[model samples]
Target chain A: MTRGFPVGEFQARLARAQDKLANRELAALLLTTEPEIRYFTGFLTRFWESPSRPWFLVVPAQGKPIAVIPSIGAALMAQTWVEDIRTWRAPNPTDDGASLLSDTLNEVAGNGQIGIPSGPETYVRVPQADWQRIKAATKGDIQSDGGITATLRAVKSSAEIEKIATACDIAGRAFARVPEIASEGISLAQVFRNFQGLLLDEGADWVPYLAGGAGPDGYADVISPATERPLADGDVLMLDTGAVFDGYFCDFDRNFAVRTASATARDAQARLIDAVDRAADIARPGTTALELFHAMDRVVTGGAGGSDSGRLGHGLGMQLTEGLSLIPNDHTELQPGMVITLEPGIETGPGRMMVHEENIVITEHGCRFLSPRAGAELEVMR
Target chain B: MTRGFPVGEFQARLARAQDKLANRELAALLLTTEPEIRYFTGFLTRFWESPSRPWFLVVPAQGKPIAVIPSIGAALMAQTWVEDIRTWRAPNPTDDGASLLSDTLNEVAGNGQIGIPSGPETYVRVPQADWQRIKAATKGDIQSDGGITATLRAVKSSAEIEKIATACDIAGRAFARVPEIASEGISLAQVFRNFQGLLLDEGADWVPYLAGGAGPDGYADVISPATERPLADGDVLMLDTGAVFDGYFCDFDRNFAVRTASATARDAQARLIDAVDRAADIARPGTTALELFHAMDRVVTGGAGGSDSGRLGHGLGMQLTEGLSLIPNDHTELQPGMVITLEPGIETGPGRMMVHEENIVITEHGCRFLSPRAGAELEVMR
Candidate 1:
């Protein structure tokens, strides 16, 4: 309805990438990754296909960025902010694309060091041939540099936060409508359809992700909807949805009792919700991501009677799970404008898991909740 | 729902991949691409985030394949035919996933030539860094053989053909329901939800792709679904859906005129349907893919008054648009058991395009329409 989010959002991301390149003293930052490319160039060229020839968004230390894409997708890229679009036709060697990309990098960087995020941990796109091509093209030394982009994307802008909040609202509303649209004899596909319908009605720009399972025990790994699994009495329905609004995403889920509630399920839901609440209470800009994990973990393990459900939750925005997770190894400090999700649950056993997820945007002081609905157990019947 | 087609269906695919490796004279094939990985190992890993860490399924020259995936996804891989499963925990670098993958590829191929479809034409899943690690670990040369896997995948097995045919049936039925469900008042998203619901109800393992658009001129690109556009009078509704069943996909589309149908739309639809009919008639075993292209092209262009719609159709199976296409350059010979789509359409003006798509399997003597429903004129509504 409303034209997709203002193009200004993409411009801001490009500017941020430029700033990162400047700060790193790198002449150019080559993005051989899909997410990085999507972040810099507001083009969705990486569809359902082979990404072996990693497309690049070459950010110069001081200048406009350039987009290197497949030749056929050039027309679509023309609609984006990256004015200079390079296209390589199919059946060509990655070496060909690499040579062109390398030439661009060499021209942009001159004698300065080129920042290439070709390290194992961060690089999953560039093939060996292309890597060799890039190496040959750059006159300067190449260094693995993913930190530049990661640091820029770690913080969310006001507009980005808004999109994330909107996504959370849509997901929450969809979850709430599940009970109204689903019944005891309903199949998982019906429930999925109902949720998808609500998502569309509410103006979800895209169904970024929809995965869930229904049973007496809550679903652990959310999956695509199917008709085989039917909701029955006392079935614990776990819905984990990642609906996108204007490219920004929010990951959230809700626990619903299909018929009469089970004492075990109800207890697990209450403890997990309360634990997440306590964790949120302690969440502040000064706290560390790991500390938040400990806070939420303590509640679920102690209150849920020795239930283990991994890390309670992680960062959410732009990505389903982004930088600075509520996991033990995450040492990043929470800052204002950083959006994240705090989800704590108990996976009682196989096919049985109770988890509640909520979106929170860190503020100058504590944090602000973006979820439209409060944390409470839900019950539905035919 | 019926349990998905037997595991034997997937085993046959692995067997085919092994045959490809032997013919190509490669010791083993390094599958870094998602579609090929799923085809060989039946392991479905969501590419929602950075799939940098390679999930390798090594099909040795002479034995069952082994998989090395992230420890978190080990259980999922075990549920498939992969005999050996190795997992490495996340967030580790030196002794992490890259090292594990490097070790595995080295052991599998060892001093022998390793087939790596790492090219500009190949879809990339391995990150630039992991690819470097693989290069470092391999004792022998990394051969860039692109079409080996595609050649095997292009030909469909009996089970694969059945799955594709079943998907076509589901898609056709969904389109049939559109006559009753779609109206001038419904939003594009609502129509999409209904289409997906019908497919899921008919028993789909997953409806991974559902995309369409509402425009005066027929919508050509089927990207993300933007459900905000409501159907209106004189509007042409274009529905292009790619339904995935048991990992195999069938991509097809149908056009309908919202409200009363116009003479231009009627004329265009009739010509496009005729072109498809003629194309199907000419499709025969031993015929080159280009012959089918010319047949469809002559009918559509010669009949629709000359507007090149680019592609007439392409091969369909595990991937949405697999192997060769009905495009000019494709010269692959049509063989029995290979299923393809005949999609011929024309867009004369904005809100005015008529395109028809249907699946056809190359038989021993000639082609058989896999999609049972015949092409029809645009549906008119008051």
Candidate 2:
């Protein structure tokens, strides 16, 4: 059921990975993170369980890459552009999988300095024994730098963009059905289930997340299920979904007017929605992320909105919320096919708040709205 | 709504953590990973949207711990035993929270070797610049060997056992309800929803996971959902649930006869179920994990009742599955109040599988069954 990314396109991605490693002066870069592995190798795995069985992709500065994976994953690994595959008995009964992976990494790294992304500065370290074994086996200094992979994955290709677009479409359609099921007297939990069911029915591999808050108070409140108290008339429902398709994710959130209407709520919602639209409008190739963020911020802060707010939006793809953020100093210029979200959310009071989010891809000339639904207006759900 | 484990008991757990750190020569451990943080400080955080903001508890060797969390979390931190709470504004319009976190960590470590739990060795690292800033700000050697935390968390407390038991009960109830709602006309997706709904109704903080195959070809597997294939008569329905109650999760699986009986499927199911039961019998206090595993292996591999196949089971708690797995050579002994699961699952073919799982808590004398409902025999829903 995994409609895998094209083989030729992935081969091209591997080539790009090789170039990145070479440019970074890395003899070899070991990929252990799922996103990094999927970025270069097109191999996706679930991380919900323990990673006792390590999957390390060795991208040498030169030559075809080798993937050291669990024996169970051998067949799946072969589907990737990576050709040289090494399989070790996973669940190694002897706790030897990590050591075996280290051995494989050492064999490929040889005396060349290998790069460890997230480097020595990371918080989570490998098992102490494994680290010692890897170091002992390798003669060269093990350098740490994940920049090579980060830079390579930061830019999106046409195929990757297509997946993001598809994910957005699925999410939008799922959202379009939310109002159909949500009604007075339904528990927030039930509504949550309905939203999730819609996403799954729409062929989403999985719904990354569905978080919401509701009540009559206002944005000043932290709305959780305990606040589940029920969606009464005039309740503002803030729902956010990070639905994934083909491993790519699209994040979308919208505040819905439930049963009742208030001028203040409508005005606030309009302003936030306008901010997101303005942000997307200013987003084009060559525009810096920070610049786009500021344009959105002006509408939010200047026009009756809360000063204390979360980031306007963020880059979305393999990970629902990617590492590359959308705050000041993030100089990653808008590029065609690189999809990002613009969410100007405001939590003014405990039970009052409004969030308007949209997914957009920077296009050749300007920008393309991945989410087909209208922006800058509240979608009243009665 | 936090089912708090008695605070006094956690004090003893902290003492145990201190003992491990002292033995390991770690000056003070910085708790970054959620499991480690929860083990040491009883702090809980959900999986992750992104690693943009680092939440950590600095457990000094000889002092009360300090919580370095995002500003909004300050109030929540105040509820914990730790009093030295430092807050970093979660990504404001212009600031990245990582900078503030690094500053706090550097200040706390102050020229001393700092031990970071679940740190860099695990492939998941702190942001590069954050690491650099910490190093630049102090002369302290920050090491990422979270072994102390791992060792501490591996052994469950009485309270932890209770929470796990609660989780297992929820999971069992979820599994038990499957037959009541599942029908030939219903899609596997709907079945999944019904199972999850039961878990939520039973007070699960979140529906951890529900994955199982639907059909009679044989091995009903556990994986992410794919096509919305409807169930059919004579299908072997395998249902596995990771239902969390009070932050602790119990992973349990069961096999049911969808509509009628197949002699082969029934026999296979019986054998697998018996193997799991025998394995649980051996999981008394002082029994090595390997011993329990061997017991199960002996029954399965010897073709007892025609079910000589599949690994025995593994440990379970906060994660659906984790810590000191019950595989061969894992010498960790069963201890009083330690919760674990025995799931001997056999998948003979596509949609043809038999699985029986149970949650057991080792007692001072032997063990107590926390999951009252056993899947030792096939449950026919014809």
When just chain B is superposed on the true chain B, each candidate scores a TM-score of: 0.90, 0.88
Q: Tell me the tens digit of each residue's lDDT in model 2 across A1-382.
A: 3356777876777788777677777778876667777777777544334434456677777777778766646655666778888776555544445566667666776777788666221232354455556667666676665566666666788888888888888888877887876766776766776676677667666664666766652443232332346778877777677777777888877677788756767777777777877787778889998787788778867643233344567777787766445666567787776778887766555534566778888889888888875544556776
Question: How well is each residue in A1-382 modelled by candidate 1, as lDDT tens digits?
Answer: 2434467877777677777777778888877665677777666532434332346778887767788765545655676767888776532431446677777877888889878665433553665555666777679878867677767777887877887888888777777677777778888766765676567556565564666677785664543234456789988877677777767787877778887777888778777777778878878888997788778777777633223223466676766776665666668898888888887767656745667788898888898988764545655454
Q: Per-residue lDDT of B133-177 in model 2, one digit per residue for the tens?
A: 555665568776556665566678777887887787777776767
Predicted structure with the largest lDDT when compared to the true one: 1
TM-score of candidate 2 versus the correct structure, residues matched by position: 0.86
Q: How many clashing residue pairs are found in candidate 1?
A: 16
